[model samples]
Target: MILLKCFMVIFVGQFLDVTSVYNPMLTYNIRFNKLRFLPNVTGNYTIFQQKDKQYVSGYIQRPTTDEVNKYQLPVFHRCNPEGLNCEYFQSWTLTDLCTLLKDKNQIWSKWYGAFDPPILCPINQYTYVFRNSTGEVNIFLKWYPDVLNYQWKITQKLYSGDFYIGSYYNPMLTYVVRIVKITSYPNITWNYSVDTYKGKYYVNGNTSITTDKLIDKVVGVFERCAPEGINCEYFQSWTLTDICPKLLDKNQIWSSWYGRSFDPPVVCPINKIHYQIRNGTFDLDPIIKIYTDATNYYWKLTQKMYAGNTLVGSYKIETVFLGLSRIDDEGGVVSTDPSGLAYSPERSRL
Candidate 1:
């Protein structure tokens, strides 16, 4: 029994010696959302393996390239002049390889080709590569329920012996991991519609006026909201118009307004009276008041902009005489400003 026990111990010792190799020391620098423009994005990561389970831990940090390079491991480049790409492989010690292979669901796996056997190189599902001003850096990232986690490991391999019996020896390097929560911007869209009107009115005793004009006007309020129906920014501006058409001989120019929020509203008159009123001339267009209230996700167009409200500007129309007839009972040329502010009965002025 003692001799048998001795033989078993010797066999086990030989097996362990052949399986275990020295692992090198490497450095790893990891970060999350490094390409984002937001502020206060600083995080770090640490990984620990206990039997079949892996534990990851870290804090956030916004480190610069120089700062991250402090933890970077040195790499020996063996570039092929003909090939424009560089390939990287993880160097693992015999002990680390045995430990990693023990986990059937290891995060890293080997690559396989169509006619070739699986290569000894390692790759992870969450691993990625990005290039900055300096060079390329390997990144391992994964999206959790509400946050993003990042990680990467660096190692070096040393080859010894013949191609058949010789083995690639790897030394342990640096491993980094980090978690961060990313804040996203909201998606927004704005729409609007306009309605036109026309009418006729008496200018000065038997001098009939027709409204068929076009006035460039913008009359509306601004609204904004978030995706989850929270945290919204809303505001409204003044609505200015040249003049109003008479009640009779009026037609609604609806279903014709279509434009983005930044575009000005197009006001087309329905009749000559409406057109003449707005086209004649005006000093200051009348301003309308606007009001808005906070709600879930809807914005209601309340009142128009009036005095004491946010006054953006006034709408004005230049004098445009289309050779239309103007008859006055007073035998004098008749002209009226669209703002209804002034009227002149002078032949020369008309």
Candidate 2:
């Protein structure tokens, strides 16, 4: 089965321009509600392969705790000889990875460099803090072959200057190594030091830090960067979760472009709940947000909502526009509507 699958992947590799597909191996969009701005995030590479004498691609997302164990997919752990045992990689060949990215136009030269790093595996974690010849900064992290035991799994975090922070699980190692990307030089430089034992995680080469203190610093950074009124909270490195408390807050004044206008409501079949929002263009924003919930499936009737000229809330309904299909090759979708019009509602918050 493995060999046959490999042949299929390699065969498909020949005909398909993976780069032309414009699919980043792993893409993440980060947003801060407080900022009143769109999300800004980049892709990361995890598995780089060579096929047909060309590079192919593979990548993984840094999943939350729940994502680590729920799926039946093959899991990777530190116990795995090469670090991560990724099964999805079966679809990609090496030639698919090395194709150069087309978008090289950076706003500044300091930001110019490889958009995605050349991935060479066998490690638990991979990170990049790129400072181009001009000194623009972009940070990225990738973890593959899921770490089975989050406890003993060690990762590294690099920052500006010669700073390296190790997510080391073994306290006894005593010698902690930090890799720093020198702004003056693109190459990584390393330093080793003893443990001072302070925060949940230590500063680059700072031995004495605990995770709690590390989290505190991250929260501080987020608060400073996030826009006002949006509640910013630490979610992970390079990302924060912002709660629009005011959007649902009772005490705050509500200000929508059309707050006084009537809201159209749509009925969701799965939960038997009605979704309501302002009419027209304002309706589009919330619908896209709900449709993009790839995990918790849902849908909306874009056609009916538009035809009825009703102000519909962001309710999940039977909609064909949101890519719900009757025969999904990649099973596990919660859709049950035979007509493919109905969508499974997200877990009801109410």
Best by lDDT: 1
> Cα RMSD for candidate 2?
25.0
lDDT of 2: 0.20
Cα lDDT listed for each candidate: 0.21, 0.20
Which residue window of length 10 is worst by lDDT in model 1?
Answer: 1-10
Write the residue-wise lDDT of candidate 1 on 167-266 in tens digits: 1111111101000111111111111111111212111111112212333343644444332323545555445454233112122111111111112222
Q: Candidate 2: where is the Cα deviation over 4 Å? A: 1-350
- What TM-score does each of the candidates earn? 0.16, 0.18
lDDT of 2 by residue, 276-321 (tens): 3221122322322222211122222111111122222221112122
Quickly count the clashes in candidate 2. 37
Clashes of each: 33, 37
